[model samples]
Structures are given as C-alpha cells and as structure tokens.
Target chain A: MIDKVIIAEDQEFANLSVQKTMDDLKVKQYDYAFYCDDALAKIQLAQKKGEPYDLLITDLSFEDDGTAQKINDGIELIRAVRSIQPGILILILSGQYRPVDIHNLFENHEVDAYVRKARHDVQELKAAMDALSKGQRYYPRSLAQLIKRSNTYEFTEFDITIIRLLSEGYQQNKIPDYLKEHNIKPSSLSSIEKRLNQIREELGFANNQQLMVFCSNAGLL
Target chain B: MIDKVIIAEDQEFANLSVQKTMDDLKVKQYDYAFYCDDALAKIQLAQKKGEPYDLLITDLSFEDDGTAQKINDGIELIRAVRSIQPGILILILSGQYRPVDIHNLFENHEVDAYVRKARHDVQELKAAMDALSKGQRYYPRSLAQLIKRSNTYEFTEFDITIIRLLSEGYQQNKIPDYLKEHNIKPSSLSSIEKRLNQIREELGFANNQQLMVFCSNAGLL
Candidate 1:
C-alpha cells in the first residue's frame, strides 16, 4: 500500500493540485516540498526515523531562488534519494517532452513512472500513481512509442559489422571480400546477400538504403 | 531596431528574470503579460494604436488559473498575434526541448527565433534579440542539429518512386521490369542500379537497405 508520499514541486498551485489528487485517492500521509534540498532532507529524515517515504514525485526543472542547493534538478534528486533509500518508488513530474531525454530517464535513472504536466495531467498523475502502487512501471503513450520504436530491433555482432561496412561506402558485392579478409564466418557473397535480405525483411525496410537510415537514426551503427 | 517588445510568461520570477535581461539590453518600451489572453489583448491594442510590437517572447505552456481561457497556450497566442500583426517578430521562450516540436515551430509557425529556458537562457535570449535586430533568425545549437539532420536530403519525384518500389519488396534486379511496365524512363537494369548507387552515395548510406531506412524515416517513402 502507498501510504507515505512526498511531492517536490516549485509551484504552489501545482503542488495543491497534486495533493488534491492524492487526497481523492485516499492517501493519508503525504508531504510537499518546493525545493530539491528540502525534498532530499525530508527523505533522509524519514529514513532516519525508520519510516522512509514509499514514493517520491518531483519536477525536472526548479526555478532558481538565489540560494545554493546541493541537488539542482529532479534527475539529481532521484540519484540522491536512490542512494539513501534505494527501494523508494521514483516518479518524475515535469513539462519536458524530449524523447531522447525521456528515454534516458528510464534507461539511465531507472525511474518507475513519468507523468507529463499537461492539460489532463491530474488524471495522468492518478493513473501513474495507481500503476506504481501495483508495482508496474508506467510511461505516457507518446514516450512509450519512442521507446518501442528505438528498441524494436536487436542487432547482433554480424548485423553491426554489415551495417558498419555499408555506412563506410562498401558495396554489397564487396562486403564478402572484406569479411573474408577479416576471417569472419559466413563471409561468402551468397551468405552476405541472404543475411542482408533477412535483416531488411525483419526491420520492414523495403531496401538496403532504408535499413541504413533506420540503423543510423536508431544509433545501432 | 527592437523598439517595442512584449513578454508572455506565467511565472512571476521567470518574467522578472526576462525583464531584467531586457533592462540590461536597454530596450525602452517593453511590456509583460501573465496570461496568453492578456498578451493577445495587448497585441491587438498595440496594433490599433499604430504602435505594434516589434517582437514577442512567450512560453509554450501556461498553468491554468481556474478560469477558462480562449487563447490558452503560446502557439495559439502566436497564431492570434500573427493574424493581427503579421510582421511582428516571434521568439518562443519555453522549457520544451522536443526536436520535432521545435522543428515544427520553425517550419510551420514562422517563428523568428527559439530560446530554451535553461541555465544560460539569459545570455541566449540576449543573443537571439541581437540576431533579430539584424533581421536574422536564431536557433540554439541543439535545435540547429535537428533541422540539419532532417533536411540533409531533398528527394525528387523519380527518387521517391524508386524508393517506394524498393520498399514494396521489389528486388533491385526486378525493379527495372516494374519501371518499364510503368513506362518510367531509364528502365534498364543497369540504369536503375546506377541511380540507386548514386542516391546511396549522396545520402552517405553504405547499402540500399540503409537508404530505404533513411527515406522512410525522412518521410520520403
């Protein structure tokens, strides 16, 4: 059960809105902080009291208040909180919508859920909280699509070698010769052609050019 | 010369920070609005008084204050202001970092410059203003990369048709037959092969599959 929650939002209205949503969900023990320093301090205090926070919700950007803060943004706060209480559920609440940055949050920080502060954010926040309570990770649909598209293809070493050769201006007919020179297996021209065709079909690419573009854009090559 | 300017930002502190930067620039007749509706009203009034704003700096997302607003977001405000005064220079000031969205602002919205609200935004905002004064457009380095990557290739109708056929599972050797059936010029097998190789070289793709992937991602086919 998610009984203890802490929200770190710089805006009073946003904080109240989130608190109201938590109240509607019947979450009894919840606290709010307007600064990253205060949020980190609360987490440390709760840990010392032998009752660490169950969930930590924070915004990625916080307005500068002229005072030096140890933790600057939500990502830093997540790192700090995770170090002190590694088991606490972390949910990011922000207006950021960059696909690369959002992908990094899940891949690097291990955030449990991401709720964008948009038009229907209250409802989305509720949904994110519910999913987290059930121990399921939640990603907004658009973000989920980005993750899915980038991760759809799993390239093997042979696939990478083929793509690398292609990107370096090697013709299909010449790739086998290079592979043979490198003592790589399946270096025959027919095998190289077949393997390239198979990869193209798997990726739904109509031609070799399209597959090259996909691999480059997806950072596979 | 930027004689008159207007800023639309919801946060008081952020507005003050922007205002302070403008003050440093010695901009004499600058105004501020906390709501998009009010900003639009100010623009209309300025247009009627024969003293239209020379530039507009606005944030994309505005927190709702319980009352319904017709001009709710910065994009809507931009459209409204453009309709009233088409020549006013528009510069977006926001925390949004989505490459696609930023690209759209340049391609569709006719924005003159975009300054992300980050740590060094004050300096960037000044640089943007300077560029605008000289009748030049300004795009942050990261946003510039997105624009460059997306615009690397310009596909002709013939090129697109070739890629489309390739994507439809037609082998390179068989594409000439389909092209001849369709009455496309240069339908010989060798000619088709040469055209494909040229395109792959132009786009820096090592193979036809990679070219296909690029075209697909670039929305060519």
Candidate 2:
C-alpha cells in the first residue's frame, strides 16, 4: 500500500540510503527534496494531481544556505504537512533531537515513527518503514528505554528557569536580581539558592557547573 | 578493473552507499570493517590468501566504544596497511576533516583520491572511482581552491604554541611567562605581544578573542 513516498531530507548521503531501501522494497516511486519549501511545493502539486504521497520521511535540521524559508524546522514542517494532508503518515529520520524530543513529537504531533541515524541506521530504517507500511507505529525499543530514563527528572518551568540561568553564567547570588527584575516568584536569594541546591542534590551533581552541563546534554536548554 | 575493494567506515548508511556504488560499477568483491583494527586484520587476511584488496577507502575519525584499539584513527590505519601492502590504492572518503587535512594526507600518505561526504556525494564518489580506476588521482576542484585559501596562513610550531595557549584560556600577557618557563625563544612580553599583533592584523581580526576563534576554526590550534 505504501508504494509512493517523498523523502524530505537535505543530506545527499541520507537520500542515497533511502533510495536504496526504497529500491529493495520495490516501492514504485519515491522522490526527494533538499529544502523544506521545495518539499511542501512538491506535496501540494501531488495533491492537486490526485496522487498523494503515502508517507513523508524527513530529518529535523535543514541547513540554511541564505535562502528564506517559511517553514523553518522539521516540527514546523510536520505541522504544516498535517494541515494539508491529514491522512499521510509521518516518520522522522534524524540524529539531531534527543529521545525526550522524540517523545514530545509523539505527544504533540502525530508522528508515526522515529528512526535515528546511527551505526545501524540502514536496518533500523528498513524495519521502521516496514512497520509504518503495515499501519503500525514504530517506536524504537532502545529509544523507549532511554525516554523512560530521561523522563525521571521532571523539571517545572521554574526549575528550567533556574538551570537556564546557571547555564548562562549567572551566578547563584545574581539569579535573584534577574528573577526579581522580571517579577518571577521566589525572587529572594535564599529561595533561589535553596531550590538550586535541591535540584543539584536530586541530580547528585557536585555544583551548578555540573548541573548546567547535565541539563545541556539532556536538551533541557 | 576496480575490484575487491575494502570500505573502512563505522556508519552503516555509508556502507550501504558504497555497496550500491560498487554494485553499479560491477565490482567483483567488496568488504567492510567498522573499526581500523578490524580493517587492518581483513587486509592482512586477504594478503595471506594471495588475493589482496585492490583499494582501501577509509574515514578519518572512528569512535572508540570501550574496546582497546591497536590502530586508533584512519591515518594510522592507512600507514599500517601501506607498511604491509604497499601496492594498494588509497582513497580518503570523509566529512570530518577540512581541505587542509586532505592536503596533509597527500603530502605525507600516498592518498589517491579524496571524496567529501556532502550533497551530490554519490556523483562525486562515482567520478572519483572512475578516475581512480584509470590510474588518475581525484582531488575535487572545490577542495583544491579551499586548500589554496586555507594554506595562506602558515602557522609555525611556535606560532601554534602561542595560539594553543590562547585557546586554553590564557591571557595574552601571560603567554611570555609560560614561554619563559618553557625556555622558548622570543619570551619577552613585548616580543610576544608584537608577534600576536602581527598575526592578528594579517588575519584582519579585531581582537585576541576573534583571533583565537579563527585559529581554532582554521585547525591551527
């Protein structure tokens, strides 16, 4: 049933891999677009011609070669694609976003599958495509376990604000001044310090610097 | 005539690309290795069997996943292979290193061709292979111009010493004292300052911070 598809990716190397996989599966037709705008235009043209693409595979990042883009990123492009073609399946093939990022995509957007570009990308991509073609969502097992591990740290907006400030080189004592200027609650220096200490202790980090790095690595800020 | 090639690369996607290309070229036999040591072992085995690989295509960087490696990187692997089998052709296919890095490969190692992993990589790779098969070297025209531009600012070992110190967060004035302690020439504060000024002005950078970034970007530090 998944005969025709369009690959919305910028990298030529990734496109070749997809082309090889599509050939192996004997898919009748598959096309590629290097730019998000070009992909959108192609999809729209296909819809007008009454030959809609069965699935849309895309990467998260597209390099801006000084070209103006209406749809900037992968998530935005997904939303745009859904608005036009609600029936089309969406599969994200990327190495950019973290496991938590993928989970967010599942919750917010109706993403069908996520195949990470990694050491075993070729086989994983094949398995993902096969699962999607069978009307099943393909969430990678390793990613599912990683999501569970990363989801343990539940950061409220307030916690994120503190960690973000720490990562930006605002010392613990200076955070109160920044918070107070913006009328953020718990603007007192003592409260800020206590909250930071609690979060650091919960994460078992030695200090703010380590906590900052951990937050960054987890795509928190 | 191009047959029995070995692809030394970690990523499966790349292996798939090479496999497709080799299949198109009608190569008799092809093999792959995910690590430098493994690639060397394969080459050695083939040599023992008296049917050695015709060419070796390798990437510059390899990830170390806890296992101890005899040969760490691609250049080392190339050297080890050449020491055993000097008749084999060498092609450097990589996306990590800059054009200058490729020039170094030409100067030091007998690298036959360099194909960058970029957009239009499939065509570029095919062309490189076709040329290599005809006993001609393939250095991309784009890389040739880039090498010419990048080679303009030649950093002596001493100049690299100063820039490396700057990249390590040392102040400009503090460099002379470190150099003095190390018994380096031109250890006077004024001499260090003058030399840095000269280099920065030649590069048209406003300050040492910008100079540090430029040196880091140019692979000088």
Best by DockQ: 2
**Model 1 spans > 4 angstroms off:** A1-88, A92-111, A116-137, A141-161, A164-192, A199-205, A212-221, B1-84, B92-110, B116-205, B209-221
The CA lDDT of each predicted structure is 0.79, 0.78
Clashes of each: 21, 0
lDDT tens digits, residue span B83-144, model 1:
88999999998774444445567768579999876545777889999999999998887768
lDDT string, candidate 2, B1-221, tens digits: 68899999876777778878888889899999888999999999999999999999887767665679888788889889999999899888776445445667766757989887665677888898999899999988877777767666666778878867755546667888899899998888787788888886777655554554445445554
lDDT of 2 by residue, A1-221 (tens): 79889998876777788878889989999998888888888988999899999999998766654678887678778889999999999989885446556667866757998887766788888898889888899988777787777666767788888766755446677888899899998888888888878986777665453454445556677
Error of 2 at B78 (Å): 2.5
DockQ of every candidate: 0.18, 0.20
Q: Candidate 1 chain A: worst 10 consecutive residues by lDDT?
A: A95-104
TM-score of 1: 0.50
Query: What CAPRI grade goes to candidate 1?
Result: incorrect
